[model samples]
Target: MAPNPGRLDVGAALSYGFDKFKANAGPWLGITAIVWAVGVAVFIFTFASTLTAAIAAADRGESAAVATTSGVFIVVTAFGTFVSYFVNAAFVRGALDETGGPEKPAFGRFFQLTNVPQIAVLALIWTVLTVVLSFIPFLGTLLTIVFGFLLSFSLTFLLDRNEQAVTAIKSSFDLTVKNFGPLVLLLLALAAINIVGGLLCGLGLLVTIPVSVVAINYAYRVLTGAPVSPAR
Candidate 1:
């Protein structure tokens, strides 16, 4: 096994991510482009549709119309979130596969349809739980963050191990709680990377998104004492 298999090396994780991402920029960039396009399109469409409905309701002085518009907004948002996660599961798979590097990242590998059902269910569960709970007043925000942080590895677990959605979530929570301190630092570092990436006209996300996903997956393997293929 690689030396100190269970040791949390945030720097090493980040480094491996950069190396692999650089080596496989094509697929990563392609994946990012589609996801980015869909996200922007969805945001604009949702905003315009909901805003028009809201304004029309206001002009007509119809409280029922306003409520219906609000409900439509929530549903659209939830659906968008579900689609995002569903697409993101492929990235999770690509990132994790790139970890054990006997093979280079193949564009076709990212679209492997064998795992579709599991990832779809996983995304559905995550979207529903996160969106619904987040609408709560005080406890909502706290619980959402808590769940988000703890279940950060949920998708990774599902992809790497064929874990069911609920089991994956629970396992991720258990694992994260085990090495809380190191993961906290790793999580902060990931946030910083993405934040900086976001500042660059959001174009930086094309680079940062794959790197962060791979880095976090690397960290997961490390924390779980799983073997990582030697970094190329």
Candidate 2:
């Protein structure tokens, strides 16, 4: 089911996302549960001891004590974040496919790591860029937010289009620039939805997260000429 290539329309894409998510709630929720459960466990296992030690050092009046552990924390956190991006890309791929066709998405599909390297490269580039810019005072935060939204679809492009990391990043940048206004609006809307989800004991994310992914992919379909079903 090929999507009609058309100008990106944020409202239509979001509507398609909401409807698609409702149609496939069970599988989406199951996948979200599995991913987040593992994410939480890994976070605790990796950082619990180190974090406690850092706190203890700070209490002992040694402000520099935490610096030693901070390197390890950054590396591990980056690694975990990289992996999560790939996993989420899988979800985006499956959701986009299911929305455009009759077949359901498979649970194992998101684990396919064929594009892991590209995703990692993209993640690494963004992390470095954001961290560097974050040191620049007031403008840093605003730049990060704008660039973050502009390149939001980099991983999805890697997974869905099989583009190289640099290529995917460029594509995402161009797409966002072409549809800058709508993309900003979409980002804000998604942020609000996620905040509401967080307020709902975090369980509401089981719905909002997938819906967000679907909306982004719906926009991807618009830009890439993939077929999108009418919003139900």
Candidate 3:
């Protein structure tokens, strides 16, 4: 049974992320490089298109330019969310594989697809929620943080537990609430890690990002009493 306020050794969780990530560094780094490269390319393409549209609209009026840019921003945000899910699927599965067994992670697993319908529905719902949340400007950031925390484990639940999309979301919230304190600290630590990674001219992300994913999976497993193999 999970402890009240479920204990999660945040340090150990981070350690597990690093350790497991190290165990499968080749695939972890390679897949991350690919995903990073693709994401940057997509961002650059979308940004250039948006800028061109805004520049063209400027001839009409300032409001027209602002409106055009805003519309393009919305589309880019939604598209980015949808595409990020596929990248997430790869890392989530890789993290799970590394923690769940003794075998070395397969590089091909990074390209394998799983839980497609759930990911699609999940991405759509998340996009809608993000748009709706954006309307509550005063509290949007706080609410987003809370929701992000509560739903952090949803993907793991979907991939590792074979949960339905909605069920996975709800289950994650429920589990997270039971373990809120530890997980909150865990989240903060992850943010700090990534912040440092970013400060290192973004080169550090190749390591921190994979480590963070592994840490989150470790937290999920420990909070739920699932098995976790040490980094071997």
Question: Between 1 and 3, whose TM-score is larger?
Answer: 3
User: Poorest 10 consecutive residues of model 1 by lDDT?
Assistant: 1-10
Top-down lDDT ranking: 3, 1, 2
lDDT of 3 by residue, 1-232 (tens): 6433336899999988888887779998898898899899889978997999899899999999999988887788778877887788888888888777668678898666677899788878787777678768769877877787888888889988788889999999999888878888998999999999999999999999999988998888787878788666
Between candidates 2 and 3, name the one with more favorable lDDT: 3
Off by over 4 Å in 2: 1-5, 52-63, 134-138, 230-232
Report backbone clashes per prediction.
0, 3, 0
In terms of TM-score, how similar is model 1 to the real structure?
A: 0.91
Q: Tell me which of candidates 2 and 3 scores higher on TM-score.
A: 3
Inter-residue clash pairs, candidate 2 = 2-227, 3-226, 3-227
RMSD in order of candidates: 2.3, 3.1, 2.2
Name the better of 1 and 2 by lDDT.
1
What's the distance in Å from true for residue 17, model 2?
Answer: 1.3
Question: lDDT of all the models against the reference?
Answer: 0.84, 0.76, 0.84
Candidate 1 residue-wise lDDT, 62-123, digit = tens = 88677968887988888888888867777887877888656877887887744567778878
- The sequence of per-residue lDDT tens digits that candidate 2 reaches over residues 1-232 is 7655578776776677788888777878888898788789769956875676577667556656567466556666666666666666668777767656556666665565567777778878876776567568989999988788878878777877789999988988888888888777777788888899989999889888888888888877777787776665
